[model samples]
Target: MSEAVISLSNAFIYQKENLILSDVNFSINKGEFVYLIGKTGSGKSSLLKTLYADLWLEKGHGKVAGFELENIKYKEIPFLRRKIGIIFQDFQLLPDRNVLQNLRFFMEAMGWDDKMKIDDRIMEVLELVGLPDVLKKHPHQLSGGEQQRIAIARALLNHPEILLADEPTGNLDPEKSIEILKLFFKINEVSDTAVLMATHELGLIERFPRRTLYCDGGIINDLTGNS
Candidate 1:
Protein backbone atom coordinates (compact mmCIF):
# COMPACT_ATOMS: atom_id res chain seq x y z
CA MET A 1 0.00 0.00 0.00
CA SER A 2 1.16 3.49 -0.81
CA GLU A 3 1.87 5.67 2.19
CA ALA A 4 -0.30 8.78 2.16
CA VAL A 5 1.55 11.93 3.12
CA ILE A 6 -1.57 14.03 3.06
CA SER A 7 -5.15 12.89 3.44
CA LEU A 8 -8.34 14.86 3.91
CA SER A 9 -11.81 13.43 4.49
CA ASN A 10 -15.07 15.30 4.94
CA ALA A 11 -12.84 18.34 5.46
CA PHE A 12 -14.25 21.82 5.83
CA ILE A 13 -11.80 24.63 5.10
CA TYR A 14 -12.32 28.08 6.51
CA GLN A 15 -10.58 31.41 6.13
CA LYS A 16 -11.20 33.12 9.44
CA GLU A 17 -14.94 32.84 9.96
CA ASN A 18 -15.77 32.27 6.29
CA LEU A 19 -16.10 28.71 5.05
CA ILE A 20 -14.20 28.23 1.80
CA LEU A 21 -14.58 24.56 1.01
CA SER A 22 -16.77 21.73 2.29
CA ASP A 23 -16.69 17.94 2.07
CA VAL A 24 -13.16 17.83 0.79
CA ASN A 25 -11.74 14.35 0.31
CA PHE A 26 -8.41 13.26 -1.15
CA SER A 27 -5.14 11.47 -0.45
CA ILE A 28 -1.69 12.20 -1.83
CA ASN A 29 0.64 9.27 -1.54
CA LYS A 30 4.36 9.52 -0.97
CA GLY A 31 6.30 10.74 -3.99
CA GLU A 32 3.06 11.62 -5.82
CA PHE A 33 2.71 14.81 -7.79
CA VAL A 34 -0.81 16.27 -7.82
CA TYR A 35 -2.34 19.49 -9.06
CA LEU A 36 -5.08 21.57 -7.54
CA ILE A 37 -7.02 23.61 -10.07
CA GLY A 38 -10.01 25.95 -10.15
CA LYS A 39 -11.10 29.50 -10.89
CA THR A 40 -9.66 32.39 -8.87
CA GLY A 41 -12.19 32.20 -6.03
CA SER A 42 -12.67 28.46 -6.06
CA GLY A 43 -10.90 27.72 -2.75
CA LYS A 44 -7.70 26.22 -4.11
CA SER A 45 -5.59 28.37 -1.82
CA SER A 46 -7.90 27.65 1.07
CA LEU A 47 -7.46 23.95 0.53
CA LEU A 48 -3.69 24.26 0.38
CA LYS A 49 -3.70 26.39 3.50
CA THR A 50 -5.73 23.77 5.26
CA LEU A 51 -3.29 21.05 4.26
CA TYR A 52 -0.36 23.08 5.60
CA ALA A 53 -2.37 24.05 8.68
CA ASP A 54 -2.36 27.75 7.82
CA LEU A 55 -6.13 27.75 7.84
CA TRP A 56 -7.85 25.72 10.51
CA LEU A 57 -9.66 22.52 9.56
CA GLU A 58 -12.77 23.05 11.59
CA LYS A 59 -15.26 20.33 10.70
CA GLY A 60 -13.43 17.38 9.21
CA HIS A 61 -10.45 15.10 9.47
CA GLY A 62 -7.21 15.98 7.71
CA LYS A 63 -3.72 14.61 8.08
CA VAL A 64 -0.53 16.08 6.64
CA ALA A 65 3.01 14.92 7.21
CA GLY A 66 1.76 12.90 10.20
CA PHE A 67 0.19 15.94 11.83
CA GLU A 68 -3.56 16.05 12.34
CA LEU A 69 -5.17 19.28 11.19
CA GLU A 70 -8.30 19.15 13.30
CA ASN A 71 -7.65 20.57 16.78
CA ILE A 72 -3.94 21.09 16.12
CA LYS A 73 -2.30 23.00 18.91
CA TYR A 74 -0.49 26.32 18.47
CA LYS A 75 2.88 24.92 19.55
CA GLU A 76 2.64 22.12 17.02
CA ILE A 77 2.28 24.46 14.03
CA PRO A 78 6.00 25.05 13.71
CA PHE A 79 6.75 21.34 13.98
CA LEU A 80 4.07 20.54 11.41
CA ARG A 81 5.59 23.05 9.04
CA ARG A 82 9.00 21.48 9.45
CA LYS A 83 7.85 18.30 7.73
CA ILE A 84 6.38 20.10 4.72
CA GLY A 85 7.81 22.61 2.27
CA ILE A 86 5.76 25.61 1.19
CA ILE A 87 6.36 27.72 -1.93
CA PHE A 88 4.56 30.96 -2.68
CA GLN A 89 4.03 32.91 -5.92
CA ASP A 90 5.89 35.86 -4.48
CA PHE A 91 9.43 34.85 -3.63
CA GLN A 92 9.58 35.37 0.13
CA LEU A 93 13.34 35.68 0.42
CA LEU A 94 14.55 38.32 2.81
CA PRO A 95 15.78 41.29 0.77
CA ASP A 96 18.65 42.24 3.02
CA ARG A 97 20.13 38.75 3.11
CA ASN A 98 22.09 37.06 0.39
CA VAL A 99 21.15 33.60 -0.84
CA LEU A 100 23.46 31.75 1.57
CA GLN A 101 22.37 33.84 4.54
CA ASN A 102 18.69 33.40 3.72
CA LEU A 103 19.02 29.65 3.55
CA ARG A 104 21.10 29.50 6.72
CA PHE A 105 18.52 31.56 8.59
CA PHE A 106 15.75 29.17 7.64
CA MET A 107 17.80 26.13 8.65
CA GLU A 108 18.66 27.67 12.00
CA ALA A 109 15.05 28.55 12.62
CA MET A 110 14.18 24.93 11.95
CA GLY A 111 16.70 24.04 14.70
CA TRP A 112 19.68 23.09 12.60
CA ASP A 113 22.69 24.47 14.46
CA ASP A 114 25.73 22.75 13.02
CA LYS A 115 27.57 25.21 10.83
CA MET A 116 29.14 22.70 8.44
CA LYS A 117 25.94 20.71 8.06
CA ILE A 118 23.94 23.85 7.37
CA ASP A 119 26.34 24.95 4.67
CA ASP A 120 26.39 21.51 3.08
CA ARG A 121 22.62 21.23 3.09
CA ILE A 122 22.24 24.71 1.57
CA MET A 123 24.60 23.80 -1.25
CA GLU A 124 22.76 20.52 -1.77
CA VAL A 125 19.39 22.17 -2.18
CA LEU A 126 20.76 24.98 -4.34
CA GLU A 127 22.31 22.40 -6.60
CA LEU A 128 19.07 20.46 -6.60
CA VAL A 129 17.30 23.61 -7.80
CA GLY A 130 20.13 24.26 -10.33
CA LEU A 131 21.16 27.54 -8.71
CA PRO A 132 24.39 26.68 -6.96
CA ASP A 133 26.27 29.67 -8.36
CA VAL A 134 23.90 32.27 -6.95
CA LEU A 135 24.77 31.71 -3.30
CA LYS A 136 26.20 35.20 -2.87
CA LYS A 137 23.54 37.10 -4.82
CA HIS A 138 20.62 39.00 -3.36
CA PRO A 139 17.02 38.52 -4.45
CA HIS A 140 16.89 41.83 -6.35
CA GLN A 141 20.05 40.86 -8.20
CA LEU A 142 18.37 37.79 -9.65
CA SER A 143 15.71 37.45 -12.34
CA GLY A 144 12.17 36.30 -11.65
CA GLY A 145 12.96 32.69 -12.45
CA GLU A 146 16.18 32.72 -10.46
CA GLN A 147 14.37 34.15 -7.48
CA GLN A 148 11.75 31.47 -7.75
CA ARG A 149 14.44 28.82 -8.01
CA ILE A 150 16.03 30.12 -4.86
CA ALA A 151 12.66 30.02 -3.18
CA ILE A 152 12.32 26.41 -4.26
CA ALA A 153 15.77 25.64 -2.87
CA ARG A 154 14.79 27.27 0.40
CA ALA A 155 11.67 25.13 0.54
CA LEU A 156 13.82 22.00 0.17
CA LEU A 157 16.15 22.87 3.03
CA ASN A 158 14.78 20.38 5.54
CA HIS A 159 14.01 17.61 3.09
CA PRO A 160 10.29 18.02 3.56
CA GLU A 161 8.04 15.05 3.00
CA ILE A 162 5.66 17.11 0.85
CA LEU A 163 5.85 20.37 -1.04
CA LEU A 164 2.91 22.78 -1.07
CA ALA A 165 3.18 25.38 -3.79
CA ASP A 166 0.67 28.17 -4.36
CA GLU A 167 0.88 29.51 -7.90
CA PRO A 168 4.66 29.18 -7.87
CA THR A 169 4.83 30.11 -11.53
CA GLY A 170 2.34 32.95 -11.45
CA ASN A 171 4.99 35.67 -11.61
CA LEU A 172 7.13 34.12 -14.32
CA ASP A 173 6.81 34.24 -18.10
CA PRO A 174 5.69 31.22 -20.13
CA GLU A 175 9.18 29.88 -20.72
CA LYS A 176 10.23 30.40 -17.14
CA SER A 177 6.97 28.95 -15.87
CA ILE A 178 7.52 25.77 -17.82
CA GLU A 179 11.07 25.58 -16.59
CA ILE A 180 9.87 25.84 -13.01
CA LEU A 181 7.22 23.20 -13.62
CA LYS A 182 9.80 20.82 -15.00
CA LEU A 183 12.01 21.48 -12.03
CA PHE A 184 9.19 20.57 -9.68
CA PHE A 185 8.68 17.30 -11.53
CA LYS A 186 12.39 16.59 -11.29
CA ILE A 187 12.32 17.20 -7.56
CA ASN A 188 9.28 14.99 -7.18
CA GLU A 189 11.03 12.15 -8.95
CA VAL A 190 14.45 12.55 -7.43
CA SER A 191 13.57 13.25 -3.83
CA ASP A 192 10.48 11.07 -3.51
CA THR A 193 8.67 14.05 -2.06
CA ALA A 194 4.96 14.43 -2.68
CA VAL A 195 3.79 17.69 -4.21
CA LEU A 196 0.37 19.34 -4.08
CA MET A 197 0.57 22.50 -6.14
CA ALA A 198 -2.32 24.92 -6.61
CA THR A 199 -2.23 26.51 -10.01
CA HIS A 200 -4.44 27.89 -12.83
CA GLU A 201 -2.07 27.09 -15.67
CA LEU A 202 -4.17 24.75 -17.72
CA GLY A 203 -1.57 24.72 -20.48
CA LEU A 204 1.06 23.34 -18.13
CA ILE A 205 -1.42 20.75 -16.96
CA GLU A 206 -2.06 19.70 -20.54
CA ARG A 207 1.63 19.55 -21.21
CA PHE A 208 2.48 17.43 -18.16
CA PRO A 209 -0.59 15.77 -16.77
CA ARG A 210 -0.94 14.28 -13.28
CA ARG A 211 -3.60 13.44 -10.76
CA THR A 212 -5.62 16.63 -10.31
CA LEU A 213 -8.11 17.82 -7.74
CA TYR A 214 -10.57 20.50 -8.76
CA CYS A 215 -12.02 22.89 -6.25
CA ASP A 216 -15.40 24.35 -7.16
CA GLY A 217 -18.84 25.13 -5.74
CA GLY A 218 -17.44 24.98 -2.23
CA ILE A 219 -16.30 21.37 -2.60
CA ILE A 220 -13.33 19.42 -3.88
CA ASN A 221 -13.67 16.85 -6.64
CA ASP A 222 -10.92 14.41 -7.42
CA LEU A 223 -11.00 14.41 -11.21
CA THR A 224 -8.61 11.48 -11.54
CA GLY A 225 -10.84 9.28 -9.27
CA ASN A 226 -7.90 7.03 -8.44
CA SER A 227 -6.94 9.28 -5.55
Candidate 2:
Protein backbone atom coordinates (compact mmCIF):
# COMPACT_ATOMS: atom_id res chain seq x y z
CA MET A 1 0.00 0.00 0.00
CA SER A 2 1.05 3.60 -0.50
CA GLU A 3 2.69 5.25 2.48
CA ALA A 4 0.67 8.36 1.81
CA VAL A 5 -2.49 7.67 3.73
CA ILE A 6 -4.02 10.85 2.33
CA SER A 7 -3.01 12.73 -0.81
CA LEU A 8 -4.58 15.78 -2.42
CA SER A 9 -3.23 17.87 -5.25
CA ASN A 10 -4.61 20.86 -7.08
CA ALA A 11 -7.94 20.27 -5.36
CA PHE A 12 -10.82 22.70 -5.04
CA ILE A 13 -13.46 22.52 -2.31
CA TYR A 14 -17.00 23.84 -2.57
CA GLN A 15 -19.86 24.00 -0.12
CA LYS A 16 -22.81 24.05 -2.52
CA GLU A 17 -22.93 27.09 -4.80
CA ASN A 18 -20.00 29.05 -3.39
CA LEU A 19 -16.40 27.90 -3.52
CA ILE A 20 -14.99 27.37 -0.03
CA LEU A 21 -11.31 26.73 -0.78
CA SER A 22 -9.05 26.48 -3.79
CA ASP A 23 -5.60 25.26 -4.76
CA VAL A 24 -5.48 22.77 -1.89
CA ASN A 25 -2.55 20.36 -1.73
CA PHE A 26 -1.14 18.10 1.00
CA SER A 27 -0.25 14.49 1.80
CA ILE A 28 -0.31 12.70 5.15
CA ASN A 29 1.96 9.68 5.52
CA LYS A 30 1.24 6.49 7.37
CA GLY A 31 1.52 6.56 11.17
CA GLU A 32 1.91 10.35 11.26
CA PHE A 33 0.00 12.70 13.56
CA VAL A 34 -0.83 16.12 12.12
CA TYR A 35 -2.57 19.12 13.63
CA LEU A 36 -4.90 21.24 11.51
CA ILE A 37 -5.41 24.76 12.89
CA GLY A 38 -7.50 27.67 11.70
CA LYS A 39 -10.10 30.14 12.87
CA THR A 40 -13.79 29.34 12.66
CA GLY A 41 -15.15 29.38 9.07
CA SER A 42 -11.72 28.60 7.73
CA GLY A 43 -11.45 25.67 5.30
CA LYS A 44 -10.06 23.21 7.88
CA SER A 45 -13.33 21.34 8.19
CA SER A 46 -13.96 21.56 4.46
CA LEU A 47 -10.58 20.01 3.73
CA LEU A 48 -11.31 17.22 6.14
CA LYS A 49 -14.77 16.76 4.71
CA THR A 50 -13.28 16.43 1.27
CA LEU A 51 -10.76 13.85 2.43
CA TYR A 52 -13.42 11.68 4.00
CA ALA A 53 -15.64 11.90 0.92
CA ASP A 54 -18.24 13.74 3.02
CA LEU A 55 -18.18 16.41 0.33
CA TRP A 56 -17.25 15.65 -3.24
CA LEU A 57 -13.96 16.92 -4.62
CA GLU A 58 -15.66 18.96 -7.30
CA LYS A 59 -12.39 19.66 -9.08
CA GLY A 60 -8.84 18.28 -9.01
CA HIS A 61 -7.48 15.00 -7.65
CA GLY A 62 -7.51 13.31 -4.26
CA LYS A 63 -7.02 9.91 -2.69
CA VAL A 64 -7.53 8.66 0.87
CA ALA A 65 -6.77 5.25 2.30
CA GLY A 66 -6.38 3.94 -1.26
CA PHE A 67 -9.64 5.28 -2.74
CA GLU A 68 -9.58 7.74 -5.63
CA LEU A 69 -11.76 10.77 -4.95
CA GLU A 70 -12.26 11.89 -8.53
CA ASN A 71 -14.01 8.69 -9.60
CA ILE A 72 -15.58 7.60 -6.29
CA LYS A 73 -19.24 6.66 -6.59
CA TYR A 74 -21.87 7.14 -3.90
CA LYS A 75 -22.07 3.42 -3.06
CA GLU A 76 -18.33 3.23 -2.34
CA ILE A 77 -18.41 6.03 0.25
CA PRO A 78 -19.13 3.65 3.11
CA PHE A 79 -16.16 1.46 2.21
CA LEU A 80 -13.91 4.49 2.24
CA ARG A 81 -15.23 5.37 5.67
CA ARG A 82 -14.40 1.88 6.89
CA LYS A 83 -10.70 2.57 6.49
CA ILE A 84 -10.92 5.85 8.43
CA GLY A 85 -12.31 6.85 11.79
CA ILE A 86 -14.10 10.18 12.17
CA ILE A 87 -14.67 12.05 15.44
CA PHE A 88 -16.53 15.33 15.63
CA GLN A 89 -16.51 18.14 18.23
CA ASP A 90 -19.84 17.00 19.55
CA PHE A 91 -19.96 13.52 21.03
CA GLN A 92 -22.90 12.65 18.73
CA LEU A 93 -23.50 9.39 20.56
CA LEU A 94 -26.96 7.95 20.75
CA PRO A 95 -28.13 9.62 23.96
CA ASP A 96 -30.68 6.95 24.77
CA ARG A 97 -28.36 4.00 24.34
CA ASN A 98 -25.74 2.73 26.76
CA VAL A 99 -22.09 2.32 25.80
CA LEU A 100 -22.33 -1.26 24.52
CA GLN A 101 -25.44 -0.66 22.48
CA ASN A 102 -23.98 2.45 20.89
CA LEU A 103 -20.91 0.54 19.76
CA ARG A 104 -22.90 -2.48 18.62
CA PHE A 105 -25.06 -0.24 16.47
CA PHE A 106 -22.04 0.95 14.50
CA MET A 107 -20.55 -2.53 14.27
CA GLU A 108 -23.71 -3.99 12.82
CA ALA A 109 -24.05 -1.11 10.43
CA MET A 110 -20.48 -1.77 9.28
CA GLY A 111 -21.55 -5.37 8.44
CA TRP A 112 -20.09 -7.34 11.32
CA ASP A 113 -22.18 -10.47 11.75
CA ASP A 114 -20.66 -12.70 14.39
CA LYS A 115 -21.95 -11.74 17.82
CA MET A 116 -18.85 -13.17 19.50
CA LYS A 117 -16.44 -11.15 17.39
CA ILE A 118 -18.42 -7.94 17.85
CA ASP A 119 -18.41 -8.37 21.63
CA ASP A 120 -14.68 -8.99 21.61
CA ARG A 121 -13.97 -5.95 19.42
CA ILE A 122 -15.98 -3.62 21.64
CA MET A 123 -14.00 -4.58 24.75
CA GLU A 124 -10.76 -4.29 22.80
CA VAL A 125 -11.45 -0.69 21.68
CA LEU A 126 -12.80 0.35 25.08
CA GLU A 127 -9.59 -0.93 26.58
CA LEU A 128 -7.59 1.08 24.12
CA VAL A 129 -9.41 4.24 25.24
CA GLY A 130 -9.16 3.20 28.92
CA LEU A 131 -12.86 2.63 29.36
CA PRO A 132 -13.10 -1.13 29.46
CA ASP A 133 -15.44 -1.25 32.43
CA VAL A 134 -18.10 1.20 31.33
CA LEU A 135 -20.10 -0.98 28.97
CA LYS A 136 -23.43 -0.17 30.61
CA LYS A 137 -22.85 3.54 31.28
CA HIS A 138 -24.77 6.07 29.22
CA PRO A 139 -23.24 9.25 27.84
CA HIS A 140 -24.97 11.42 30.42
CA GLN A 141 -23.49 9.41 33.27
CA LEU A 142 -19.91 9.93 32.21
CA SER A 143 -17.75 13.00 32.65
CA GLY A 144 -16.85 15.07 29.61
CA GLY A 145 -13.48 13.41 29.38
CA GLU A 146 -14.99 9.98 29.79
CA GLN A 147 -17.56 10.69 27.14
CA GLN A 148 -14.89 11.81 24.71
CA ARG A 149 -12.90 8.72 25.51
CA ILE A 150 -15.98 6.68 24.71
CA ALA A 151 -16.27 8.58 21.46
CA ILE A 152 -12.64 7.79 20.73
CA ALA A 153 -13.30 4.15 21.46
CA ARG A 154 -16.18 4.16 19.02
CA ALA A 155 -13.96 5.61 16.33
CA LEU A 156 -11.33 2.94 16.94
CA LEU A 157 -13.75 0.04 16.65
CA ASN A 158 -12.86 -0.48 12.97
CA HIS A 159 -9.11 -0.13 13.61
CA PRO A 160 -8.95 2.47 10.86
CA GLU A 161 -5.57 3.34 9.44
CA ILE A 162 -6.27 7.08 9.68
CA LEU A 163 -8.29 8.92 12.32
CA LEU A 164 -9.90 12.25 11.42
CA ALA A 165 -10.81 14.20 14.55
CA ASP A 166 -12.51 17.58 14.23
CA GLU A 167 -12.20 19.74 17.34
CA PRO A 168 -12.45 16.74 19.61
CA THR A 169 -11.54 18.74 22.68
CA GLY A 170 -13.79 21.68 21.86
CA ASN A 171 -16.27 20.78 24.57
CA LEU A 172 -13.80 20.00 27.37
CA ASP A 173 -12.15 22.03 30.12
CA PRO A 174 -8.38 22.65 30.04
CA GLU A 175 -7.56 19.72 32.27
CA LYS A 176 -9.97 17.52 30.38
CA SER A 177 -8.56 18.72 27.12
CA ILE A 178 -5.08 17.78 28.23
CA GLU A 179 -6.30 14.37 29.22
CA ILE A 180 -7.94 13.89 25.85
CA LEU A 181 -4.82 15.07 24.08
CA LYS A 182 -2.79 12.57 26.00
CA LEU A 183 -5.24 9.89 25.03
CA PHE A 184 -4.77 10.81 21.39
CA PHE A 185 -1.02 10.63 21.85
CA LYS A 186 -1.34 7.26 23.45
CA ILE A 187 -3.47 6.03 20.57
CA ASN A 188 -1.00 7.31 18.00
CA GLU A 189 1.97 5.85 19.83
CA VAL A 190 0.44 2.47 20.54
CA SER A 191 -1.49 1.79 17.36
CA ASP A 192 0.66 3.79 14.97
CA THR A 193 -2.56 5.09 13.46
CA ALA A 194 -2.13 8.24 11.43
CA VAL A 195 -4.12 11.13 12.93
CA LEU A 196 -5.36 14.31 11.28
CA MET A 197 -6.80 16.48 14.03
CA ALA A 198 -8.62 19.78 13.40
CA THR A 199 -8.45 21.96 16.47
CA HIS A 200 -8.06 25.61 17.51
CA GLU A 201 -6.58 25.04 20.98
CA LEU A 202 -3.19 26.71 20.66
CA GLY A 203 -2.13 25.76 24.15
CA LEU A 204 -2.32 22.08 23.32
CA ILE A 205 -0.58 22.72 20.02
CA GLU A 206 2.19 24.62 21.79
CA ARG A 207 2.66 21.88 24.32
CA PHE A 208 2.65 19.07 21.74
CA PRO A 209 3.92 20.49 18.49
CA ARG A 210 3.72 18.44 15.30
CA ARG A 211 3.44 19.02 11.57
CA THR A 212 0.57 21.50 11.13
CA LEU A 213 -1.79 22.51 8.35
CA TYR A 214 -3.23 26.01 8.49
CA CYS A 215 -6.29 27.20 6.61
CA ASP A 216 -6.76 30.86 5.72
CA GLY A 217 -7.98 32.91 2.77
CA GLY A 218 -9.56 29.80 1.24
CA ILE A 219 -6.37 27.74 1.13
CA ILE A 220 -4.81 25.03 3.23
CA ASN A 221 -1.13 25.68 3.83
CA ASP A 222 1.37 23.15 5.06
CA LEU A 223 3.47 24.83 7.73
CA THR A 224 5.98 21.96 7.67
CA GLY A 225 6.57 22.35 3.95
CA ASN A 226 7.32 25.11 1.48
CA SER A 227 4.06 27.05 1.11
Maximum-lDDT candidate: 1
- Tens digits of per-residue lDDT for model 1 on 57-105? 8998999988989978989999999999999999999999999999999
Off by over 4 Å in 2: none
Worst 10 residues of 1 by lDDT: 46-55
Which candidate tops TM-score? 1
TM-score, cand. 2 vs. native: 0.97
Model 1 CA lDDT for position 188: 99
Provide C-alpha RMSD values for all models, in order.
0.7, 1.4
User: Model 1, 35: alpha-carbon shift in Å?
Assistant: 0.5
lDDT of 1: 0.93
**Tens digits of per-residue lDDT for model 2, 67-95:** 99988999999999999999988988999
Per-candidate clashes, comma-separated: 0, 0
